[model samples]
Target: MQLKGIHHVSSLTADARRNVDFYTNVLGMRLVKKTVNQDDTSVYHLFYGDERGNPGTEVTFFEIPMAASNKRGTNSITKVSLRVPGDSALEYWKQRFEEHSVQHGDIQKQAGRLVLPFEDPEGHRMQFVSDEHDQGVEPGTPWEHSNASPANGATGLGPVRLTVKTAEPTAAVLKDIMGFSEIQSYPHPNDTDLPDIRVFETGKGGSGAEIHIETRSDLPAERQGRGAVHHVAFRVEDADELQQWIERIKNARLPNSGFVERYYFQSLYFREPNGILFELATDGPGFEGDEPFEHLGESLALPPFLEPSRSEIEARLKPID
Candidate 1:
């Protein structure tokens, strides 16, 4: 299977505006698109990433007002890392965190990259690292200096990194099925139980391996719950290869056997050994289906199946504003 890389990472949050504020304000990521969940219109489906909202850089969230406990174990989200410019940018982020009053762990290094770990408003473990990744999409830089008087600002989504249970079948899927070739490896640092951090890029050293996967800790496993990433999606070249990927998953003894087509592409969902859900998504019939890329997420989009309910669905949606 020749899968490209991540299409986007979807997770849960208690509120949309708070999540938006954290990404756009504190982190300096652009709200690429603002829209509502196709299925559950009541909740906003927010997209945050670089200028064009390219693959791998996009991290999505669902707003479920009822607060839930942050879950962390062997199968949950351990950490989410994004690659920024470098070590100097990290110092800027440190000052920014202090200014925003956002709590974060001390600066640290992992796999030869400088990382600054922090949590979102909802407790989602997220970090920004100073590693230069050339995402094919022209990356965006922050427009204004921070109010904290930092030398720099938090840049756009670097690379969305996820901690997996193990690097086995998931790693296999990445290399063999997904078409992500091994780039290199690095140690997880002294304090972490994580093993050597293996690197893989989407294609021909394609800019920031859209969906970069790494195991948080090799010691044991964890469980998924609130605040942890629910699933990550890898983009496929087209529908044919995507269909083939569905069979490949079953061949690997993965249990996802059905195809649920979203507006832009089709998807196959199955849980990896570590319990984090993995989504194989087709890259085409893109955001243009409802609106142009420049204007995407500006309004509600309906899947073909849900087109008939446009009025009723719009009516039922909660007032996110």
Candidate 2:
């Protein structure tokens, strides 16, 4: 069955503040909420995205203040990419990056679209595309939060982009069983200079849109570790559709790890041959479960299992402010 689009991309990092600054300052994502990790309240859970912190457009992080240096493993995504409105958005980002003094990779076209690649302060690689389409959200910059209006900031979860270590089985599963059709292909969108990169866009290409899988076959496979993507989640209409996908994954004999609860949603994790962690997640009982939409990401939220320990949990969390 075909899935909607990426639900969210979650990763681990050693330093929380640096991660926050890089995403907000360099990338222009709004730090919607600052809270503690639900699984480990001692750590921090940072959510960054378009204004109002909508789903689909979110890039989430679990901060391990003292995490060891990461190895870019095959299973973990090396870069998290975002698709902007088009080439015109580049000038805005160019000035923003220069303002922050963040080191950046030259503009290169990948997956049939122009993309500006840059790295977070903690060395997490990220890119934004110039697709010239409705990105469906606005993004806020840390340097100009007070200046951001309701209209200019990212509105919700948009597309989550990814790069794969290989294209064989991963691309195969997506095409064969996952029902993802390869829309089209072209030279890298950012530059006509580099070798062509295969771009796979899934879904209708809407907000919380599908990923653009790129490969630098010349580069080595990444090692999965902290500051690296844990998994790229795709969304379903609800739990029922998710169960259907579980059966589909089983039917295909793909290596699936059954289901795991993420408090707000249930998930099934698996790996496509190329080594990227893939997750099937439900959209129900979403970010609004623990708190009102207006108050989300503003506090530490625990699942039912941890509800009884709220007091202890709250005591262990560091103040976000």
Candidate 3:
């Protein structure tokens, strides 16, 4: 059983209302699911994606009110990349970011593709990469009601960049356990003298299915906070495939949370050698399972297990809109 690609990246947010505003109104992604973290039902778990909240398209957040700012350093999921239509779309977003007063840098090339780096108000690192040359896992359709034009809207997740004190251990885990292939490397953006960032790809290898690992010995381990990524999950076909992955992780002797029922999808979570949390998640029974397509993210959603406590849960969360 091979992994598909990125399923979702869950990050932290202190302000659920502002987070929803930025991702939906600014980035133009659809707020596909308004849910609570299953493990801790006290906070919001917001999911933004393309039209349908497909496997490779989601970017989620867990609300942690008044959390401190993230301490930037190594051993972290440093940067997240979102895929836009093409080169011209990068230009479109550049202008849009300016109009919205979003902090961003000039468009540049990364791994031979055009990318425009930016940050949310809370300082979460992110970039928009042009999918002009992508050939692998297909991207999701942009939301029809997005504030940004569909042609220029973000489509799906691209390569996630991880910064660590050393890359070999993490690289080994990715290659040996996750069935990823080391395709190529590119010079680190900040220093050519440092180790080159390595690119790894999985099923259908493309922007949507790759991981970029950067070695950063000079920095300390990250102190996670409101702006830090919680974990990155890769795509599994279904419960059957996820079960196989659970066995694989167990066979490898890695500690993991096996077979989590997330309602929208099933998952297994484990940390790699570098301490970066990784998850293998099933793709189906998606966001549409609970809410109607048109009214997604309009109300709070909890898994069947949590439904009994919906009123209590709802009372704790502040309205995001």
Output the worst ten-in-a-row residue range by lDDT, candidate 2: 135-144
Best by lDDT: 3
Which digits, one per residue and each the tens of the lDDT, describe model 3 over residues 178-289? 9999999999887899999999999999999999999989999999999999999999999998999999999998889988988899899999988899999999889887
Reference-based lDDT, residue 300, model 2: 65
lDDT tens digits by residue: candidate 2, 165-230: 566566688788888766655565455674454445556664345555555555566664466777
What's the C-alpha lDDT at position 272 in model 3?
A: 91
Best TM-score among the predictions, by candidate number = 3
C-alpha lDDT of candidate 2 relative to the true structure: 0.64
Q: What lDDT does candidate 1 reach at residue 299?
A: 69
Q: For model 3, which pairs clash?
A: none
**RMSD to true structure for each model, in Å:** 4.0, 3.9, 0.7
Q: In candidate 2, which residue ranges exceed 4 Å CA deviation?
A: 24-28, 32-41, 73-75, 106-108, 134-152, 155-165, 187-195, 206-208, 215-220
Order of models, best lDDT first: 3, 1, 2
Report how far off residue 227 is in candidate 1 (Å): 1.6
